[model samples]
Target: MSIQITTLDSGLRVASEFMPNIETVALGVWFDVGTRNELPKQNGIAHLLEHMLFKGTSRRTALQISEEIENVGGHTNAYTSRDLTAYYARVMHQDTELAIDLLADLIQNSTFDATELEREKQVIIQEINLSRDTPDDIIFDYMQMAAYGNQPLGMSILGKPEVIAKISGADLKKYAGIHYCAPKTVIAVAGRVDHAQLLDWVKKYFGQLSPVSDAPIPPSVYKPENILINKDSEQAHLSLALPACGGKDPDYYAYSIYATLLGGGSSSRLFQEVREKRGLAYTVSAFLSNVDDTGLLGIYVGTAPGEVAKLAEVLREQLVDSSRNIKKAELDRAKQQLKAGMLMALEQPFSRAENTAQHLLTFGRVLSVAELIEKIDNVTPADIHRIVGKMISAKPALAGIGPKKSMKVWEKFELT
Candidate 1:
């Protein structure tokens, strides 16, 4: 893929790829600051700000914002994560300029009306309530808390209801002013984009953004421990996490392959051993979460309450056995899966735009498809063993939610 990157006078970076065959363009502005940039009291403000920005701007009402985009048969949305927040749109190539203008208006001109603020708080509070009631969903948050404790990294992006209610328009404005500067932002576009014209549009629209750097991000120190939550669910939900390398670590690719081979699909060790063979769990999968400084390699399992302890034992055995005897065939399969995923993403404009933006923020450059595949290809059986060895040797953070009896089993269980 051909990608071009430019830095505006204001320090905002712009990158684009021209997909001449596609009729639509996917574009977005991404900020380096997110939940990790907030203080303890400001836990959920980043997400609240995401909703409020869509509520209204100085030049348009909230209805007008959605109306204009939809009138053109386009779509827009935003999301907040641990280390990034993004506002994005997909529109016909001819409407790319309009998308850019609308996004600019959002960051620069949002009014943050008090009435809108109160209404949106209730909306987010409902969202929090919904998440709490979902066993599989809330278990990850408990896992995060178990891994990172009370630090910014461990805090939920949704924040708490009491804190959300306390946040005011002025507080949002202050946070935005401190974190939404040009030096901490990236604008990316993919599919039928014109580099020169796009660069001109970015300069004209985002030139006024302050060049100041964002507030210092808090340290995301990993502190491993076990945590349990009592609930009345029929199935026991368990999340096991071991601290691992971050996005920038040389071992990132290796760790990703390790996760994929361990429990990523039906043919994976955990799925075959825990589900197909032993009938211990209905759902078993492994995943990786990475930020700038730290990461988590996690396995999630859902099973009958009576089988939760056996599930943990199976997980430990699989991990240990895989480390000692990871096969060449499985390693090759994992690499192929990862490479196919990257290639498939290349066909979608939205993925290209989002991945370009993230790569620029994380690595200060767009990694070529070739470079990425080569990294995955270089991972050997020894590398898989190395990552697995590191993971099982470290203390794992265990988080469980289920009936009282299931919770009791987890309380007495240790992964190592």
Candidate 2:
């Protein structure tokens, strides 16, 4: 069935996909405000606010919120990302109204208590420290810094420890007021849902939200950078990135196909070349991150310090080779893999609901199952070749963490 959407008079979007076969529903409130929406100094406010929502609301304490949901056999959680923050719940079909009302209460009635804010501040500080202690996790942050410099686009979603410490309750409330308005919010529900009821709940709970008048954010530049971190570590962590197509760009599908063929799994070129055949690394994969107007084509590999040099060479070689040497069979397999993954994701209510909300925010509408498949099918070997060449021709950005000797070798992978 088609996903239904309604925009309340207040500008909040209500979207729903009804799957009749199941008796469970996944629903969420998705907001466009994220780390990038913050001021330079308020890096972690978006994420902190996400945590604060669960701590308390006007009518329910944090424990009551959890107890009520659990008593009904439902699970509720939230996450903050670079572009959006989502609070979602999976509940039995009969509890759809309850889910939407709960989400509404969290988003609109949260008081951002001062004491809760202090405790969450320390918790986020520890979260930051934990990421730093994990080499592979922290290397991505360093890679992002190298790729886009200090812009919000490049900054860590978790924010810096120092900045997190200084983030006060006033900061959280003020940021939320400006960004969590009707114009910036979406409520998406999938599975055993009624579009009419969802719309009604939205109007009842969110119809009063006033739209904020904030200035639009300008596009972020993708500047190339390279950083080699010397640390004592058992394994070397490496991330190499090149500029690529954005989320809404025409080449998005082609770039995705090429990335999958490169290192998506055990059957991929990078895995076969770097891990299976040579046994250089246990973990190696390619990733594509696409924001509103910018994107990155990147690879991450974790291996023993001694094997960093060899893995780097193989990665560079495979990337260069893929632009021209990609065969029809490899392209076909990648297409199938991507198509299957897409179809499987649609079968899940959470993925469907999340996609609906995110798509409405990103493209103003959700792509139908046929629409997504057709786009993925339209990608040809020539398209892959063209985008691969275009993406890799730019100077690559590199981030690595290892002993000094391994990092010295890491610096040698640059094309220039």
Cα lDDT tens digits for candidate 1, 209-302: 8898847887887898888888887899999898888899999999999899998898888999999999998899999988977899999999
Residue 328 of model 2: what lDDT? 87
Model 2 scores a TM of: 0.97
The TM-scores of all predictions, comma-separated, are 0.98, 0.97
Cα lDDT, all candidates = 0.90, 0.86
TM-score (C-alpha) between model 1 and the true structure: 0.98
Residue lDDT tens for model 2, 1-416 = 67888887778888888898999999998888687776668788888889999989999998989988888999999999888899999999998888878888888888788888889999999999999899889988888888988788888899877888888877777787888888888889999988997787777777546666464755678897888889988899999889987889878988888889998878999999998999999999998887878888889999999998788789878887777788989888998999999889888999999989988988998877788888988988878878878877888888999899998888878653
Residue 135 lDDT (model 2): 89
Residue pairs in collision within model 1? none
